[model samples]
Target: MSALPRPARTAGRIFAWTVAGLLLLAVVIAVWVGVRGALAYQHLQRIQTGAAQSTAALAADPSSAAPTLARLAADASEAHQLTSDPVWALASHTPWIGPQLAAFGTVAAASDELLRESLLPLATAAQNVSIDGLRPVGGRLDTSVLAGLVTPAQDAATRAADAAVAVQDIDRTPLIGVVGTAVDRADDLFSSVSTAVDTLSRTSRLLPDMLGRNGPRTYLVLVQNNAEWRSLGGIAGAAVVLRADDGRLSLIGALSSGDLPRGFTNPVVALPDEVTKIYDTKPARYFQNLTQIPDFTVDAPIAREMYRLKTGTDVDGVLAIDPVVLSYLLQTTGPVALPSGDALSADNAIPLLLNEVYLRYAKPADQDAFFAGAAGAVFQALADGRGSASGLISALTRAGEEHRLLAWSAHADEQAIIDGTVVAGQLPVTDAHTARFGVFLNDGTGSKMSYYIDPDVSLAWGSCRPGGQSAPRQLTLQLTLTSRAPADAATTLPEYITGGGVYGTAPGAAEVVGNIYLPQGFELVSATATNGAGFAGGVHEGRRVLTFGIDLTPGASTGVTVTVRANTAAGDAQAVVTPTADAARAPVVVATCGAG
Candidate 1:
């Protein structure tokens, strides 16, 4: 057959034309989307560059970043408009690459929202308030400056929070390649912005009152000594009453633990049954032991009650800071002169206040006086606004991050606002997205030997199984305690440093009670101590608690590794460890199951 029938030929021609037309249309649509996406990507890159520059500029001069903020908003709006085109939106529903398109558009929209609603408004609000304005003047802060920023900060925080939620709601599982990476990066950026702004907002709302805008406010400042570790850092070695009236701050009174009652016949506050069972009534009875429970809400009340009993004054709030915090502040203050004729700087503040004070002074009274002098000098520097305001802020920020700066407001309303903040000094709280573990340390040796401790905490998430109420993920927390004490520390170290053979610990040895608090929903698989060491286990506040008594002689090291199965699915893992004399190290995270 040389030729086909006419009908068959006509049908074949029709089919060929239809296929050609469809192919051409597909090509046109692809080209259109590609061009738009390329332009959007260019705008996004510009935004990123502009944002980085704006951040630096804002830090240097908050008012001058308005131009950059405006440009960023413009770029973000253009990118959002391009990605939101009807054709681009329609193509985003397709398979495979559809998720990529959707993610790109989501990022653009979120960026636009943040720039316009949060950043721009914040820039405007910050125009009148510079870092210099925050510096103290005659031991007083101009609360009005921050008062003006409250409304704008609140608005920006709300917008930022909403934007963060929108960005985080994007499901990254289906994304791949560069799109996945971009989405993840965007998620992180938005989340950080939200958190930072939220803190600012809360601070703006709370600080004015806390500084005594409404009335006179008096807060008890607990200067903890990290040399003898407690659950919340260390014992309250010293205390000061800080008075604030209409934004003016002054140290009204100061005392050391030696000045307070040694122990109470009864607890100033009722101890929870679990707390009593696990930690006994020491946390409530002794002023130094108030922080032994690792909860400032409880620790603060007892501290206030003790102060009231010692002197008939009730504080409005309690703020705690350790030697590490003092060290951080010293970085900004340059150096403060102590009563001992030595200058305390950031480099030597930790050592001098924590270690040398004990060794140099044989009597507790002398040590207390030395500590009080150091505290007063540092406080005077801060009150005089002796350093760069930004540097001071940075120091405080670092201290807060290290859990060395803690606050507890007696007011219910203010306490509610501080509940989830880093400064609240509460135990680690876990959620569906983040599982938190706590490594609280308490010294059983009753000595300042904790200054020689070197702590290394590591957390890892193993494989995950998909079942149950949620995915069950395996996790491990490894804590290593190394003693840096000299070989002849028993004789070389002061009697106070070695506990004088008290607390049942051998001289020149450190007995640390390591309390490992597991995640609330996690089940303990095993808690293994290196070298077959013994441990005590219990349940506290709906979480499994493992207590390891680590006795490290001179140059000795001990470790505890705890493995558990987390029933709740979480993408992030956090370990809150007690602040030590040594610089805080970040928790080591090895996540095989995608838990950070």
Candidate 2:
């Protein structure tokens, strides 16, 4: 309003211009970061595809994959540098978007570390000892080749596992939208790679010594029949004693459940009151029931004693496998000829071994003989190196993932490495990151009726308290069991398959004992059975157990829904159920938790 204020107005105008210039600079920086980030994301998609292809080729041609792995490592390294550039680092200190920026940098760094330090080194080592090098030749595995991979595998596994932990430790709650999702995806990828490498490392360490590098080792191989459910897949009806000496393997003898005495006068090993209360001495007394308890650590010892009492041969370890695994192996070994003139191929192994044998042979003795012969033939083919090495490895990996292959060792150090793995056949483990449940089934029909039972498992978690709060969260597990047997099974099916009511179960009805083991520290709030089925509760290995007995006649169905509360909230909820004759049942997880 006055001429004397002219100097003050000019000063104000200069200050306004300075502020506008700074804002423009900020806009330029934001646009640059966005464009770079989009390019990085596109490149990462290509890296992921290349990584999958390279990994697949590693088993076939390790040397050829090295160049691709190195290129991926370079791309990941570039991404890390781009995300941590000076401008991006400065913007990471901003208030609202700071956490997102930091998370991006963290993920990029982790990817770089995983590819360069873990996978690249692994590719180099794999070239030295390819998957083909581990195959059995002339009925013997060359242990020396496996022994050579132990150190390199351990190194690669340790690096990858450590990287995975770092990625998993990133707190995604503070990040917004796609940043949080990106963190989760990275965590999943690292966890899977770490698990696979760790398994390889463990195998490299265990196989040499367990294959009799030091001395002779004997193992009792239980060929579980999933048609007759036991807690650990099925009953051990057919078995063989395998001897390993200086990397050479030979089957000493074959035996059936009938070949051994039934119901030992006394338990082979002292039983815990919990076990005896639920299972009595049945797991130890009857050879067919040895897997009824669901804990292989305990079952293996009893099996060793049973074999000793029956054949006077002391075994160094115990192994259990279902016909599903045999079928997987057959995919590699081609068809094996059975004594009955029926060729056992990958396509027919499951139904033939689990069902057709029962229908073809009315007598129990004939069925056992056929099963034993099938098992022996498969083993002989594998021992003769009759398949692709890479195919064999893939088959075993698939079986182990499904918990269809199990092992137990008498040696303490080796057993320690095997304990927490899928091969251990232990109860599902729960921790801060995962809430795991076990839904195991054992047949009470005293017949091979489980092959006709189909299972459906669904898991869902309730809304959880935000952040690091220690409030309990709810998880619901719904298991549906459907009987697929024909309506006139009692009259049309073989008496041997139906049990003929010998064990007190109705002729055509299937009786199943379902044992649901809750996660450690989780409480079972409620268990409701459908169709008037009855359930009981117990405790095993410090976990809550819910037992349901469901009796289903031909063309009938039933189910049990359980609600449990976790001590701490977890985003990952999983269930491991009994492996049946059907294709593996993947648990369905929903966001809402309820009986519905």
Checking candidate 1 for backbone clashes, the offending pairs are none
Q: How close is candidate 1 to the true structure, as a TM-score?
A: 0.93
Model 2 residue runs over 4 Å out of place are 1-22, 174-177, 464-472, 584-596
lDDT of 2 by residue, 1-596 (tens): 55658888888888899899889989987987777777677656666667666766765677888889999988888888788888888878888777777778777777788788888888888777667767788888887866666787798888888888887766555766777666776777788778887888898899888989899999999999999998888999999788888778888889998898867888888999998877888898899999999889999999999999887878999999888899999999999998889899999999999999988888778898899889888988988888988899889888888888899999999999999988899888877667888888999998989999988888877664332335678888998899999989998889888888998988889998889998888887888888876678788988888888889898888979999896684557778888888645542222321110
lDDT of 1 by residue, 527-554 (tens): 8888588778677778778877888998
lDDT of 2 at 432: 69
- Per-candidate Cα lDDT values, in order, are 0.82, 0.83
Cα displacement (angstroms), candidate 1, residue 226, comes to 1.4
- Which portions of model 1 show Cα errors greater than 4 Å? 1-22, 49-60, 464-470, 587-596
Candidate 2 RMSD computed on C-alpha atoms after optimal superposition onto the true structure: 3.0
